[model samples]
Target: MIETDKNQILLNMMTDYAKNNPDTIFCYTNAAILYETPRWEELPLEIHTVQSNKKIKNRTAITHIRPYFKKSKYKGFNVITLVDLLLELAVNDTEISAISSISHHLYKNEISVETILNYCQSQKQKSGVAKLRHLVSFASRLDESPFETKVRLKLYVAGVIIPVQQHQVICQNKKKYRVDFLFEFKGRKIILEADGLIKYSSNVNERANERQRESDLIREGYEIMRVMNHDFENGRFAQILENYGIPKRRYYGKKIVKKHY
Candidate 1:
């Protein structure tokens, strides 16, 4: 709910509160923010905290009264352990949301899949342990954004061949380029780009730079497919992949019914 600027302000307020109240520990999303976990979005309405003593009555914050397995200090603030934050997210958020959050932090090297698995193993009887256990195997540290994770998950669920994320390729000109997603088909190297309009179209120079980069990649004999946010919203990504001859891994459940072009 909080925009970028507002989110920072809210976090600062929560940090100040944590510093003043030694008996309270920031947990859940609050702690995730303090830990600098990537792609972890906090609710703007309430600051999440865990009370170590008497509960505080506050409208802007939600207090959790529970025994945390571990605690740590980050930026001079008492915060819940990273493992606890992951488990909290797993239980509180949706499956994909939880997976994406964990994957982002993993990609940032703030946590490890093994650590999460170990925690899940120790808490097998917990509320979200089963779901977390199931999703952890699919989480990748290579995914750079929640959007990319969503795209990858959709492709996987539809039985499409999994592609490499943040793939690096050396161009003929001796310059290296990193692609969002890369696949190989019929001996052709294909690059799939997930483009966020705001990020790419912020200014004229940025747009031109991206175009030039794509041109260079194409010149290097790689087939490039640029997919926008709307494409996914309109179910166009599947058609795009199918047109490129990306073979399906296996057929189950409702098949990806191809539309006539």
Candidate 2:
């Protein structure tokens, strides 16, 4: 198991022990915690209950037995499987949040497209199965961050040509630079960067390295567009893409409510 904080350590130990018992199954966010999946939210203190034949008296854990439960082992530990965990998340969370969490696993190569698709296919007439199918179709293994996945999905939904994610280009000096998004339009190479404040401002060396990397890419005929989290939050990304010749396919027609005569 990966080294984590004290609380997480305690939670993991509890779940690990729970796996040994036959009556209870660790699941949902708790399953995710045990599996060490990348998540957008902080780890909750309460354990998520998947299945139990008897009442669990632990107050640190939340129990929900509504949706059906299944037990499986991952890496020799008995916990809820990834497919079931994803289905639960899809039913409970927003579409984007579900996609983002799944994307993190895909990006890390911890999960595969075929594996998810196969699992989704096995569950017929299940709630959230259709939505999971659609969401999984948009899942890209190349996304390095949640922001990158969001931007890529937006571009895809808007009918714009999807840029290559994490494209690596070798500079003249034999150094390779991997860009977040790379688009080739009308013979111009454009690079889109999702600039997070923590990544760029955490250290002077990091900032300097980024500057040098940008300068090298620019010298090699690459046009760089750096976008922060606020740009997407404020809905400025579409305009930014439009400025660079990406066509918008989504049309927002003016609302026309029917009037009573």
Candidate 3:
């Protein structure tokens, strides 16, 4: 829920605008909230009618579909401006970590860091430019999921060198596995695994398969570590890293404590 009164007022304000202006195409944050990333139900948005055929919305909800919620960047491709999206994210009273997660999706699928940074360069005087820039710094296309992105941000704060995402390693049986994170410290191969439940919740056998996979990696001279959602949230994984004797650039107590920590 969007707990801010200002955001509530904005949502009502935008909804009113959308109601009054039928056939309106909400742009930027407005469009983004209505379409792809609806973090809050009540977000202040500026609803505008781009074209009669583009989109139409009312007080009840948005209508006419524009998936991806972006302006066209290529021939017949629907794309949102990277800067616009990130800037809106920064101004929405959102936590930096949440904003980083959102930015990760945008970076992974829609835009490149160079492109977004170049665009940000032009928005120097914008209201949320500073926060937007910071959030973008944590954005990574390599993260396969939002949990990975969250882990990555914590790692950054802990001052650990970011790991290589989805790193492929060859095992003793001549099999190859794409690990979640990989770091080389003190000339040792350390693998950090983000153990999200969806990876194995569907079947009991998936868990067994995972253990076997880890066993294989260990047999081939790789030091392995695993973290679940709770470990990342509470920062307990940092202690595990210390216990394993991984070299860190900094000593952060209960901090990150992953290649992505």
Best by lDDT: 1
Quote model 3's TM-score.
0.61
lDDT of 2 by residue, 88-160 (tens): 6565555565676578668767578788888878986788776776777667778776667767766665567
Determine the backbone clash count of candidate 2. 0
TM-score of each: 0.68, 0.68, 0.61
Candidate achieving the largest TM-score: 1
* Candidate 2 least-lDDT 10 residues: 252-261
Give the lDDT of residue 48 in candidate 1. 42
Each candidate: what lDDT? 0.64, 0.63, 0.57
Clashes of each: 0, 0, 6
Instruction: Kindly indicate the candidate among 2 and 3 with the higher lDDT.
Output: 2
